[model samples]
Target: MSIQNFLSNLDPRLQRMVLKNEQLEEEGLHTEAQKENLIPVIAKVTNIGKFQKITGVQKVTEITTAPDRSGQIVTAHIAANALPTVNKSPVVIQLQGAQPVKPLLKDTAREINLPSPQESSGNGGEGVIVGIVDHGCDFTYSSFRNTDGSTRLLALGIQEMMNDRTTSFQVYNSQQINKALGKPDPYKELQYPVDKYTHGTHVTDIAAGNGRNNKASGVATKADIIFVEPAYWDIPRGNLGNFGDSINFIEAVKFIFDQAGNRPCVVNISLGTNGGPHDGTTLVEQAFDGFVTDKPGRAIVIAASNSYADNIHTSGVVAQNGHIDLHWSIPTNDFTLNEVEIWYEGSDTFQIEVIDPQETTVCRVGLGELYHDGQIFASQEKSALNGDNVAMILCDVDREDMSTGKWTIRIHGSNVNNGKFHAWIERDNHTIGIQSIFAASRDNNYTIGSVSCGHKSIVVGSYDAKNLNTPISYFSSAGPTRDGRHKPEISAPGHGVLAAASLTGNGVTGMSGTSMAAPTVAGVVALILSEAKALGVNLDIDQIRTILERTARHNPPSQQGWDSRYGHGRVDAHAAVAAVRAMAEGRQPLPSAVTQEEKEALVRR
Candidate 1:
């Protein structure tokens, strides 16, 4: 089917947006000079089976089945002439430019006093698979090898970007990866290289590394591993593109599920983005929730994000017919472009106006306006700005334009019932000359990033284990999601964690962040899964969460119950394992010593 035929079949509202996107592409709205990045649009088609039967359109690229069999997910290039056809589909979900999730990077797993592989009754995740979906991994690292020196990595899926701007997606069994490693350029033959970025290697080591050289062993030393490295292309002047999109994440998860077969798997995502609605409404978040649901022995762990100290989030409420001004301080010497997004309730409507430092009106967009000319934004960017019921402002401040200094955004309420909104500055790690600062605000709710905010995923916060009081890490993100759901459901030791280093074969290094903390939880979950498997019981996501929360070790003053800062509290692997054992034996688990009311009082104080 041609793009037009596919688009013609979509709902009228979707057809308008998709058509507008096509028009923008034809008009060269995304020219090189504009610096507007284009991303794939993921469509969830409920009647995919029906649509495929009538197929004459181009084959959908990067196709994956929705876990629940609800539909199919396919990626569409922004510049493609033909859009995929979904005739009379009940629902279609679209998202643009999910920012690349940066590594929240590490820790001493032993600090939490995890049980040793030999001491753990279930053979330390002997039958479970620990899937690390990050950058590439160092499959040659001895920590990933068996006693016979064979690789424990069951499979590897590599998503690479070719020079022609096409994707090179392939999956290889352990035998293929091992055979390729013997060649001069293993990556060329195997299609996936050893830990080029290093983050994946360290994370995998912490979760399932075998203790070599008498070093500290990971939580699930015997668990198999499945690694994914999504292909990414670097922009001419900026960092890599296509790194953080939801498509890659979903594809990675699908690959792991295929490889694991019947074995229980615990997937860890140490990377995250603060770009989307922190409420679990995005298509990617929903897909993740669907993937884990009803799939017993399957779970995903995500970092709570490292934006707590970044000061990029500002929140406020506007009264009826009232307006609020937000100041964003841009450093004087910075020259790179920046992005700002404002999210509000779906029922509320607001007008957004951006003013540069010199009081020039850069642009103004109303609630229902169509800013499709793309003079300053990509098609999806324009769609997100005008259609997603949010205000997305991109500031391209060059040194010559005097765009630096205090820029102001005025948000005027047009219709207000629930007038609250959360504004965030896009992460600028790769943009060398840009920095964003938002004026402090009173209502900074929903600071957690995407994927981590997923309702089904276990989001982990970080704490300093070296400190006697175990204070929450200053950089650990806090959250009661926009819709008011408690997040970072648990905290763990993330400060000064030592684990295997990717660059040196037998070397170890120390790193910190919620990234490191999440894998700690993932490793523990692996152990739990192993124990549960032995007991002949399959534990789902909710059961695992409850066991972890009940068995967690909290500080004296605030013992039981959930807190935004420390969910149920610091994770205790040994206690969690014991509790799982008790439950498996048909005996009641031990009760908490502290009462729920006391915990609430501590939170209030």
Candidate 2:
């Protein structure tokens, strides 16, 4: 897999844990099925998604069989012998020969032929599809419009209201988007409340905005667009709602890729969670790896989360025949749930207990047991990676006088050998600001969040786009995953990236985060896809990763190749695209013969 080739090569991403909370009925979370299950579960799916830690594979049923232009995608469900199998895939990529050159990409208008496809005359991501899976997808923005005032969006998928949770995919094709653009209130016509979410619009614009608003255009201006708005994405832990799972994120990516058809597609994910075994084997991460490996001409880019300084991670070891207590601080004002996952070598059997801030043992679970009350839930399960075990505790208060501040989790080593463990507090996505944290033993390292840590994801870190003095954004997470795999393949301008304000006609705003950087890479990858399509070449995940890493520019100049912060260095779109053209032409893909002026020119852009 190309992920192994990433930063001395190794892999990592998480399953969306369904917490029994009322907010599950919102935008990306509802499915009706989840609404009724009122308890936080690491749910197992019998079909149609990815699964992890299934001890045996009793059955393998191919859900859908079709030959993708790149390769065929065979999604299957694997569950433990007693439990219904999870919809996970042991992804098999049977690479086919070069696909015949397809037509010019949708709405591209013209075909380009240049010796160096990255030249200004080369198409700006034409002949490629850019998929965006995030919230607040506003297709009405001018940046998404063609020169003729028509939409450049290929399609948009929304997880509709709760009643419609069981309904089929609610899709808006290009015609529907165009119709919405003509109405008095485009959102009313489209049924997407874009005003609530500007994140998607900003990310999409950065990846493929056409620059119609006199603002800076995105990297792949002419690339076609596909978007999916997961229901639970917009509001994070609002109304004392339960914590939402990222399974919707996986579904969102699947929908985008499904909608993309055979076209070369690059999807951007500016969303992630701070919890998961950093070893890249969580069910959802498995899904990500499966999807990316399903075929060539497919790739996913994720923001390498901003939890670097959040104190969301901690690590320690329990002495054999001894015990340890982990302190987790629940903020005084936070009304949402707090979840912490402790991962350790499975060879050691540990009994766990969760104590509230009042110093009372609220719930206890021994080896192979799961304890759940409305307020506290604890469990110990076989880990999906490295034959390890995961101890998880989640708190959902029941009374008005809820416990606040440091909660202690006690881990007693019953059978000890390899008693070391790692833990992470869940991420906060909304603006309420308050979040739980580890009170002690916090480690900023290994902070790249799940899905971004997936083996197939092109994880991106943030550079201070607006502050050259700081180069890297303070919040951009540092990594070499828990398993010691280099992460954050590259860095890009994220801070202060200005783009269209959600649902505001002609309005723009500036936002900062690693979320802003990932889309930048997605757009650049689109250019690479476009070039590959033009040259009639087939590119798998590994090949694309190689090109990007090979062409990255050294950030600090003296820093040697491949560090945890920036896998290669900062991404160079022009160099990446040029390398693609060079590969197709059988020349030096990343030629080192460029003149001083050309290097400066690339730097200037």
Candidate 3:
């Protein structure tokens, strides 16, 4: 694949950025200030030949080449003047930085009735791998060690931010990890810090960590683990910049899959973004879907996100020639600029007008137009908001305009007959003190997020183990995705679930959210794969999903079939393992194939 093909296929924001960098380079804008604005991107190619071609054209650096010759990973400093020429060549996939996906976590493992290590010893997930792509991990944690006190970690990949304004990837195998653990400072010995954020260790413990002192045992207790910590850069004002981007995530996934070799593997991703179209059309989503499709013994599980109760999403239908009004609540004391993205069917055209809380028209911009008013500027563009064909509104709020009231946005439909539009209030890990509300009759669905909305991935929602009567967590993101696909295929114990704490002496800790719920399912998948591998069978993703749904325990208020809130219901690991065993014995039929219509529908967005 050629770099030009990859650049052309990138998300529009990234495509535009790369093209702008090429333009600047052509104009001799090579000064430090000019180069500072250039976008850094990672490109994954099919082979070393394509990697060489890309590096020859751009200032590219190799991240890693797959040991199996499956692909090559490289990063490039895309300048404004060095855009590659497009030619007839193979299409190469590329991705850029997306909104950060955060950690969701823990509890009473007893709530889900996790089997004892002795009980599951016959199929103790020995031949399977549990891959965790998250923050840093605590390799020295007892939970990650074997009964002999040897490390159970198979490999580790650390994505580091270099001082040269580029990113570097360092991978360590079992020997290296064990050597580092033998040192006085294991993290320093490995030249990487411990799980300081603590998110990765907690998540990893929930999925495959062995019990420490007979406490906090995770699913797939015997499964080997592989982990990655994506690159992160801390910026000013308490914001984390350049962390959890799509590029690093893709690379991490590739690394895990390649290293798993012939072993059955399941990867758990508790991170997600609410930025892209709820339909999985982004390059990252497409790449993942392709990787998992038709590939038996491989799976990827993701968090359904914690956006359901955030009051940040508003959706409504626009009648032909009629208008709808949305109220955006801006906090009074915050002076930071905010952004809100509105998405509608590409075929439909609409107009948006913003009125200040003081009842003054501040600005109104239609599709592809930029509205500027000194410090307060607004803009709308087509296919520029996170690579989706939607209208985006960027608002730079002056401190004087932060009146802490409902700012009115009136949207008039031009050709909309039955088309619907969704507006999302952008959220960061830190508090920005802004909220959004729709008319009482409007706001209904809140079950959507980047990657979670993907068609093939298993998106897990959160439930409360402590309260069986109210098992569904209030924060769990529920979904009939934007494309009307029932998301969050299942729910799991996430609230107050106890797991290993990082950097502590055989410590146990508890956290809550869908992040915790996802790894639970990943661990169960490991168990299933382990059993299937023993039975000389390779389970497809669809088969694993069907087994889970069939064996899950339905919570109250949700029927036996799929429900938006609980998917097929709370995950039942014991029953799920039993079901896989039944399938192996030819007592049950395999899952039905995905219809061609269904396959096409996944990418329709």
Candidate 4:
């Protein structure tokens, strides 16, 4: 492959790193760049050995191999100088965006036939394992402890800082957690004071908290818990997409399953980024699909996303030999970087040009090319695996020279066989730092996050569980994937959900997001898995989706079946378990899809 072609295959971050390498060498900063540059990536390949050998890899770990044995997902680090070798040999399968690492839930458990810990054991999810991969976890929370004050977390993997330009993890088993709990200062002795952000702990509580001190209980309270603090956001205050990431979640999932060792395990990943094809075909989504389908009694649930009103998506049909101007605005005083990804048919090509807020063309990326000015960057590439094209506009607001305001993106159709194209603003947390968005012709559809698009993933959206209407959360993302496949198989309680607060000594806290909803479904899945295991019936991802689709309670009460706001509907934990029991007894058969009448008829009370 030519150097340019090889460069196009690398992710946007690594591509920039490669181009920057030569400049740094010229300035005698090669060593400094090496010290600060550790590029960790997840790639799918047919031959792992060849991929490692060609990439000059010092270490390689296998995350997952697809169920149909299509490819293997592996993590390999590339030095700044090794960029040229990235996809030249043993090609690295690409996802959608160039997400850099930055530092970056829950429900009632009683709906699933749980009385009280004293009255009943709540064995509905007993003998199952629940896995959590999120920003951080608080093992010291009483909700995560047994009645005797012993830790309920089976294993906790905390991502350590990058050392020698490589990511590492420090794992603690129940024994180690117990040892730390016995210390005079557990937080000081354990060396992890991540209570400031209780994201992981809250989500975990919604999945497996034991209802300590009469707090809000989770569905799978009796299930063992495995928590993973993702490496990218393990530090202090990082945006969701600014820090280099992923592959850590895959590593964490693999670790949890390894520890599970044939025990029915369900993983709840309450975090995701809006940077992928959203077609269940990206390498990351492929790996997630593999995780659940590769074995029976295994499942994964992810947030549908919370960007419904973010105005991050826009779509239009570019006329042949004509152009469409897409307006994008960068909020003022924004210090962080922002980007937009455009995807269309691979057969058609478009001329990409970006006009700044000042109405001056900053950069024009040609067909099958990459362009980079000091403040702006652009690129277009055709996927060799999936026959889809992806183009991107990235603005570096952190640069002093970069301007912030309304910018116009001009996409001129060249070969207009299929002019329909969709563009998305990559995930930005938009805390105090201003976030950029599409200013005009914005779209709300196809807002589901990256990995949640997987076919086998039971994606969960957020809803107002406390409201009488049980309304869909205003922030819950809408989706019918890029390929027109229904996503977020179900919705769940997320608005003002009462769950655990980290390091608060059994105190309860209320938070809301799709992150809270995912664990609700995961906890319910654990109940199904536990019952399945006891009945000597193993359930695969297909069966799980079917059971969920058939059991969810419709949101609008008369909306019939699936809608973008709520897939099948809000999750019904009790209905799902009953269906699982019926399936185990051979008294009920799983239906493939909602029938026409099912979509037309109002959901009767």
Candidate 5:
């Protein structure tokens, strides 16, 4: 009998809710008996109310055929009232298994309409090392090499050395090092050699592999990928409760950071600890935050863990009893705020770092005075063109302010011959204290400073492509550090992306996640660093974050600005390149200290 008949037989009240139409045909109903017997049978026998209770579905709307012709299918458009009140309802239906789709590769790869990379005319990110901490990488894969004797992908086997009893580096045979060196295969015992599962390889390819031989490309096509294997073969017995120890992870990080390589490099950590970092129990923080540092051109880019599962920090923060919390607050008891004092010891005399904010850590250095209205003002002391420190002030721009005037931040360059001022912070002044107010406004980027909490690291989040349809990957992590600061200093593409993978010979694999997202960013960073070096612009990680955040593409304000989900909306590679060019030509202005509003506004755009 049809599902409807079954449901009607089970409960007559369900008859009106279940209907038959093209949906059944779409489900591939090949025979009349199957069609006639399924829906009514399902409706008659199925407990609609019980099904709704279990699935958070309102009244059953329709009983359709399965996408595949295997069986009858049912779908429901849930009601607002049917949302899970106590806990999230797990999806009960098992989806049909699908084969991986091979990504299409263009004959000539093109970057999304962002301006061509500044240093991309020649090799960019060449020789820079990026670390991928995941399952494993297949060094023997062919896509890792190029035809002209240049290595497109170089694999540093981290898993092979996992269980070696020797503390000495020589434990790895000469062959393994040869593989790392891109030399002919010389190794004997190759356990966990090439990444058997495709996750790590796909991620590595996006960061480094050259788009040669009809392969999908990566953003940093010239970088070297160092794979840090976290576990042995998937312990089929692995369970959520038994998260594995990541000693190899820590060791891999230490090895990369300690490498005395020549090229200025950046490390990308796409994986995130499942629990919230603020819970104070995740070993990830102990390994990452305790070690990653900001020293000149070297840095690390970490993806905020995606909020797929319920989070006490986010979900719990929602106000109950009609007390909706539109904002987060800093605890008054925290001494980090009251102890704020400007300490300057760096050689750069033109800029001072804003170290503390109402106990929240939103650290960034700008050329200006700490002003009221929670902003940093550029110094008008010198009538320096564009670089003058007066354009960084942020205001809680109400409708009146928008109607009356628009605010702007300035950038200054050393090449300006005339003493013209470029102010980046100039808005009406308000109360000046070391605290941030949790208000919903376009200029509230500074209010949630989680991503920037670890001011010393390069924190990134993800956004949809220009086409913007599709759930933001549930795997991409969000930010607003436990301390109430904006995090993921910026956002990038983390979705159903196509990139090169380690298949046997010049092969490719397809996958998606921030794991792919972060390497694309690291490559961009490498390009920026190259431009800065060429242009003689001495920049720091904070400067890069502020520049990227300020110049990124802006989405509508209906979506919160600098929210944990998408910090600084989507990255505008073109805008970033333009900013770099303008800075190099002395056409751009230097930014003043940023106010909460100004910073938020920059990030929102």
Candidate 6:
């Protein structure tokens, strides 16, 4: 029988036990389910015909009524009608259409397998410094407490140098002069107040907030943090831009690294402009690559931009001229056959192609015949150019007005009713693919970080370290770089991750983003470095990336080779630590640093 008919015949008591008063005998659900009149009903046991002949039960478990017609009910197996069910003795309650329960971490008695006791002293990032290139950190956070329950960050670098306090943390006038002179300010005071977004504090918590007092802590909980405020947002003015001009960023990156010295440090930038390398070359790259000395363990991490332009907004334009393809910003994914498309404008035809970032080619084409329909015709074929160049495809269309003039480009991952590709028509090109970072969902560009001034260093990605089946967040940006180089290098736990936040503030907020994911890898890096110190083996940034990538748990679901989405798959801190430990003991092959110089050179260039 159909569900409606079957429910209508069931006894009222049976219905209450199974369907939770889903449908009424007299008036039906809609008539009786008035908002205020609706009441939740607990399930009770009932009897059926021959089904009861097998098992015996006194009563059925209670089910709550839907609130205000906002619920549905169904039934399946319950305790036997003949068998006695003891109270609170793990009764097997069965219901139809119940969502499958995801096993909790606790349910699976998998030991929290950290490395050997000495390897996991929680001092992976000991002595190293990380700059929270964000708003500002709260020096008074309770997470900075020591074993004796005293706060360790009595004075932070930013708070000390910026504030008027007389402790050693104070930023003296000489330091202020150095900062003003474009030199490294060892005593630069914490400039922004604690309440400004609390971004720096939260980020600091992820990178190095010592896990104190059951507080949310980061991977490298004991590392030092330098707060750098690079973004200033004015809600009234709608100004959400970087602190200084591009030139200022060049100076800032260099200064941070200069102060880092011999210890390994990572400068984390969680911000970006709205375009590609051509439209915007992360201003810091100019200085970071130019002047900073290549210390053994120092590196930088920059956030991929969060800007996205659909039909309503477009930020980066992609076009081609002749054999050469030009892009204003990095496309969402590497140029595959999947991304290329050809269009017909009346009798003419034109094709769109995305080229490699490193190629230097020029386009030899211009605006042409206009077409009324979406199709554009191929007017002619020009000679192959030497470098990347983008030009408007010649098309036939009538338009004198540039303002509000629209064009369309077919796209994927949109809401197309049929199994057809969607198209976006906007005034400018959409930001192609900043959303493809390792663990970043499409919502915000939080977790992505560039290695240095250059875009080449490992931009870490996210994975559900605890749950293997969950898909990588839809927001995680994917990349092969614009040049098709495997990026993000690898992944880590970025979902529902526990980490520190401002102490004086809410102290903790459940956060999920690539931002949360990157630190897991960063923490592992700290562990590797820490182990290296003990073994007296010097390692470089490239070596660290290689070790992690080689030891990364291979995910078969990821695209062929290393995919843009998952990269090398989720990182295993324990596995990575083990690999590094084995290498230190000469039991396994050490990861090669072939990409190290290239990575550093990319930053410098």
- Estimated TM-score for each candidate: 0.84, 0.79, 0.82, 0.91, 0.51, 0.51
Better of 4 and 6 by TM-score: 4
Winner on lDDT between 1 and 5 is 1
**Across residues 1-605, which tens digit of lDDT does each residue of candidate 5 receive?**
11111211111111111222223345664354323221111111133345556533433433322222222223332321222220123332221100010110221123333334442332455555666665546555554555554444344544332111111122233345445446444223443345344776666666666666465656556566565664423211101111112333444555565552544566776654321123221222323443433245566676654443222122211111221211322333221211111111122223322222333323333432233221221111111111122212222222331212212121223232322221111111122322323222222222121222344556665544524442345545555554356666666666656665554556654455556667667666766665566666656666666666665544521253565666665565545555665677776443533233543443233
Off by more than 4 A, model 3: 1-36, 41-77, 80-97, 105-108, 115-122, 163-165, 195-197, 233-244, 333-337, 371-388, 396-405, 431-444, 590-605
Q: Which stretches of candidate 2 lie over 4 Å from their true place?
A: 1-122, 164-167, 233-244, 384-386, 399-402, 429-431, 589-605
lDDT of each: 0.67, 0.65, 0.67, 0.74, 0.40, 0.37
In terms of lDDT, which candidate is strongest? Answer: 4
How does residue 411 of candidate 3 score in lDDT? 83
Cα-based lDDT at residue 422, candidate 1 = 85
Runs of candidate 4 exceeding 4 Å displacement: 1-6, 29-38, 90-122, 234-243, 399-402, 429-433, 555-557, 590-605
Q: How far off is model 6, as Cα RMSD?
A: 27.7
lDDT of 5 at 75: 31
Candidate 1 segments whose C-alpha is farther than 4 A from its true place: 1-39, 50-98, 105-107, 116-119, 163-166, 180-197, 232-244, 332-337, 372-375, 378-388, 429-434, 442-445, 556-559, 589-605
Q: Give the TM-score ranking, best first.
A: 4, 1, 3, 2, 6, 5
Q: What is the total number of backbone clashes in candidate 4?
A: 8
The best candidate by TM-score is 4
Tens digit of lDDT per residue, candidate 1, span 1-605?
A: 11122332222223344544466566656545322333345556554454344333223444554545655556543333233333333343442333555577123565566765444567888889999887758777778877766778888777765433335567778898678757877666765545543888878888888776257777788799998876532222222223334566676776787678778999998887777667775666766777677478888898888888777888889999999999988776665556677878767878777777789866666654423232222111123212335666655555545667888888888889889888888676544525577855634446677667767888898888777788888888888786788797888878777777875767777878888888888989999999899888789888888777776766722755777867778887776776667777787555644344443332232
Clash tally, candidates in order: 11, 13, 25, 8, 86, 65
